[model samples]
Target: MLTKRLVTALLTAVTCTITTAAAVPAQAAASTAIPVPSTGEHLMPAGGVFEAGTAWKLDVRNAPLHANSAGMVKTVADQTAALYGGVAAFNAYQYSTSFYTVPADQPRVDVQWDNCQGKNYTPPGLLGPEGQFTQVPIPADAVPAKGTDSQLTVYSPSTDQLWEFWVTKKTADGSWSACWGGRIDGVSQSDGFFLDGFGASASGLSLAGGTIGIEDVRSGVIDHALALHMSAPGTWQEFSYPAQRSDGFDTSVNRVPEGTRLRLDPSVDVDALKMHPIAKMVAKAAQKYGFIVTDKAGCTAVVAESPQAEIAATGVDPWKQLMGSTPSYSIMKNFPWGQLQALPRDYAKRTVAPATPSTDPGTSPTAPTAVSTRYVSDTTFRTVRNGWGPVEKDRSNGESAAGDGRGLKIAGVSYAKGLGVHASSEVIVPVEGAKTFSAQVGVDGEVGTNGSVVFQVWNGATKLADSGTLRGGQAAKTLTADVTGASEIRLVVTDSGNGSAKDHADWANAKLLTPVATTTTAPTITAPTTTAPTAVSTRYVSDTTFRTVRNGWGPVEKDRSNGESAAGDGRGLKIAGVSYAKGLGVHASSEVIVPVEGAKTFSAQVGVDGEVGTNGSVVFQVWNGATKLADSGTLRGGQAAKTLTADVTGASEIRLVVTDSGNGRTADHADWADAKLLG
Candidate 1:
């Protein structure tokens, strides 16, 4: 129950702009001073006449309330409540037109009876034929009443169908008001009271149905009605109408204000919900809305991550969770969503390229005074090491081929002369400030005896950290260093003191990797080291030539069905299918890379124009040669985009390969765009 003052305050808050506020009071004063309408000569039509400045009030209520929760209070009394459950709002309706003429001597007023019960009440009732009117005899002693509910006798002067209404006195001023009462069961509504509000028209009404229509007396406009079918609970729906109907009571004119968030049902599926225009927008930004799962205890809901609490509180997915009646974000008019940036990568170094490569003599592979193809024995080489391995050599290469010509090779200079290791010996290569380092090294021939290897981080010429021994020969050895900030690092083979007769020392894949950097700035693509890429035959693929190409910049790599070669400069490779391939889509461990400075996030945009296959994705990843920098998972043309970020230390090769997940579906035709590395 609300008091008049409370209702007034609520109304003021809800409707701030109403013109002519004091007009109602002033008009009421003037209307109270006028004579009653009993003596008027002309009578207006039943549904369309106005009793100026007069006000009518009605109270409607519904019965019975059951408390669903333990502490909730009961409000509704029993079935005795006036309104069955109907909400208060006036409605006026037109029945039939008729006229009433009052005689001068009787000092009477003409009151027309318009059957407000719509078409249901036939001619026998007040909705009778023409020449009939409901004329109410006013008491001479009544004090110029502006509102009265006295029964009236009406007379109609026309032959057309006549209507009836309990017409009241006219206010001195022009405005008029009317109210109606109807009961509805099971519906909930406020205890409504109306001092001044008019009713209007309706639709889907017929004389055969039990629908009633009420109209504004002054304007003869049908204002409101009671639809008997809506008397049952849950049978009626609330609707807002904005325009003036025949009854003149058009109530739904206000627009929804800003900061209004409508919550929709949570059970909706994404694809199905997209059919609705609003739902589609929310799905597009699902990532921006994260969900935090928790139990009643306010703990991390995960079993092992944190201790399980009795009451875990977590954030629900805002986009999926409905807050009120609609699924919409309550964004302020000035809020900025378009200005935020997306981040994808996790590394900082640029690309993956070897520190130096085997090249033609007269070429400055290291300190190039000129360019030339130079051949030197393996004895004069230094090995580049992987900063990550346990060396995992037993898996691929046998013990004999382990550490064989597989480590990093620094071209041009002879390690034999630079660091002074005996031909049959090994020494430590030092890298300073390196917390840890890993590398793969190879011994060209056999190391029958004195097979020894040393790895260390160095400051220029001093060894800061070292790995004491390495089993030699074609085997690969992994080395890690914990020292930090070393200006120079080397992996040296001291004395092959065992003298196993291993001749040359060769190194291939080397990684000088560092931890992921923390920065917000996005990385930019550098101008390529080579001229604009030109299509070339496979025979010319050299370390120098390959180093110049940008990752994700080459031609599309279509799946093998097109007979496209994967061995060339990596031009024209398109993915025929995409699914869960072993290294990328299939397994979480697989990675891809993009050539850019610093750590960057990588996304694979798989384009599928309705094609199908199991090998439909192109994995855009960066790697320090054999070591992966970063990798993203399977992306279908249907899915279109997926992103993963990794850290890169220096120049690295980014490889996109499509491996079939073996789903055996006609692989989807997938195209890939260059990877976008976000910050």
Candidate 2:
């Protein structure tokens, strides 16, 4: 019987294999630019690793083979069968390399030398003139490759530098350390080797140069040479040109040397083989750029970027989606190992022509549309899961099927557009390039102050914003999140610690703000002017029912502070211990439109109400027909009120608005104290 540890290892290995072969989005393959999940940056330039004419990037189909090509191929096949139970396979998650790309702004930290492996070679100096250990821009969430080797690689396109580490691990002090590693400068211009004889691999080859990238497989094309690890390599210390050093221990004379390129026979038709899609892709690449013996490992295998780190950073598993039901171990089982030919050491060194540079910028070719506002009610969601009735659009969640719901209302306030869902519900929306997602959320009034639920927004596994527990009939809370670079957005509603009873939730006026390209144009400046009131007449805004109101939470209140749940349950408007007898009380994201009635000015003292203490933050603005106005920057509860005065001369109407200060509207009860108009 297999031990528990062994069974777990086997299961993990199988899972890694399946994930490694999974497919990527079709758009990812069509676009040469592949995003790094860790930093949302492009993996590398369009050419895919190494300089144009470098050996790793060379097309070796027509290259000459060694005189003992047949003998070398047989040796490799025999060694592979002996080590891997008669078939070669791809090393995916375990004993594999994982690479990451960081942007210019990534934080830099020093990597200490742990010397855990006790290797003999001297570690290379840092990118700067510093000693062996130096600062590298490794993401805080960076994960080393699985297995004992723990190989990790990082590239910074902004600096054109590459860093590789072995036995990488985090220290007790929350810093990083590695057993051995090397740094390469001018990576785009140098040969694909660690010149200082220091690297994660025994052969001193740059992992970034030959490792198969996810995009390469997604595109169905491997343009560069693939990295091959052999359990038996020629001579303990002997290596070929392009390989600066070697740790090969096999002394057999017929063993393949490190850096020896091997290619699939060009005469064979790879497309006709009974092979997995991933295997076919590997074969095509082998027939083109071939494979370079770069390292010695437990088994003879090809190396691809481990999907573990990418999956950790992003909840989506690209490999599982890419390979479907194809088992990873069987990917290369049908490969034509017998027909492989070993090329001469350092073959085509001076003959292979340099590849032409790509004109692409390594980004999506199609430009996104201009930035615009879109409502969630107008868009189709990917999936919807609800605890009770089906998710309803533009209405409150009722007990049964679609269209059985009523109007969406919270705290006696109605919404023209929104999503109605029951507790323990999830609505997933695909928003690849959206800039921001915003929504007003609360328990639907249909629950009538009964249910308690929490609203949350998520981008993959990362939670963007969350609303605290809210009861039915309470003023709605506003949620806004920066969703740039996210592939999808999840709107989730869950019961607040209790059992799901009447937990009908409403996401009112939910919308997305997407970015678009803008052309440069000359700026237009207008002169500022002030209009004086011709007559003195004042009227309080709270006394008028003729005004139109839109509140984030509950209904706009008269002469009081916005309270929790039900309407007409508010207290007197007060801020920082100061009380106002007459004022308009509203929630954050509230808007009030009143007829100007020849009023030349509008004045109000705005602040987050003291009733909720310091729990709320909001910004107050007064608009005069889209003209000159006054704005009270960001105000928090328990703070002094900010006095606002706006010139409304020649304006048909004036608008008073309160918005959450970039934070979720948890307790955003705002007051327009002493709000009045003068003519």
Best by lDDT: 2
Q: Write candidate 1's Cα lDDT for 327-415 as tens digits.
A: 11111111112221211110011122223222212111111111111111212334343322212221211133333323222111111
Where model 2 places Cα greater than 4 Å from the true spot, the runs are 1-47, 119-128, 349-679
TM-score of 1: 0.19
lDDT of each: 0.24, 0.69
- For model 2, residues 1-679, the per-residue Cα lDDT tens digits are 0001110256344532333223432112222333332222223221354533455765667777776788889988887666444546566656666777665567888887775534222322433355435778887888887877677888764466788888889877789988767788765445677643356776778877777766566545666788887777775334564665454656665678778888999999987887777777888889987888877665677776777776776775556566555555555655777788988765543322222122212212222223456788888885468989789989888987879898876654456678999989999987757777767677887777789899999988999988767776555554667788898899999999898899999987687766455334679855557765345888777755436467887677776677544444355578887877668889988888877888888888889887676678999998876654888999987799988888888888778888898998878889999888887
| lDDT for 172 (candidate 2) | 79
Once superposed on the true structure, which residue ranges of model 1 sit more than 4 Å away at CA?
A: 1-437, 446-468, 472-474, 496-504, 514-679
Kindly state the number of residue pairs that clash in model 1.
187
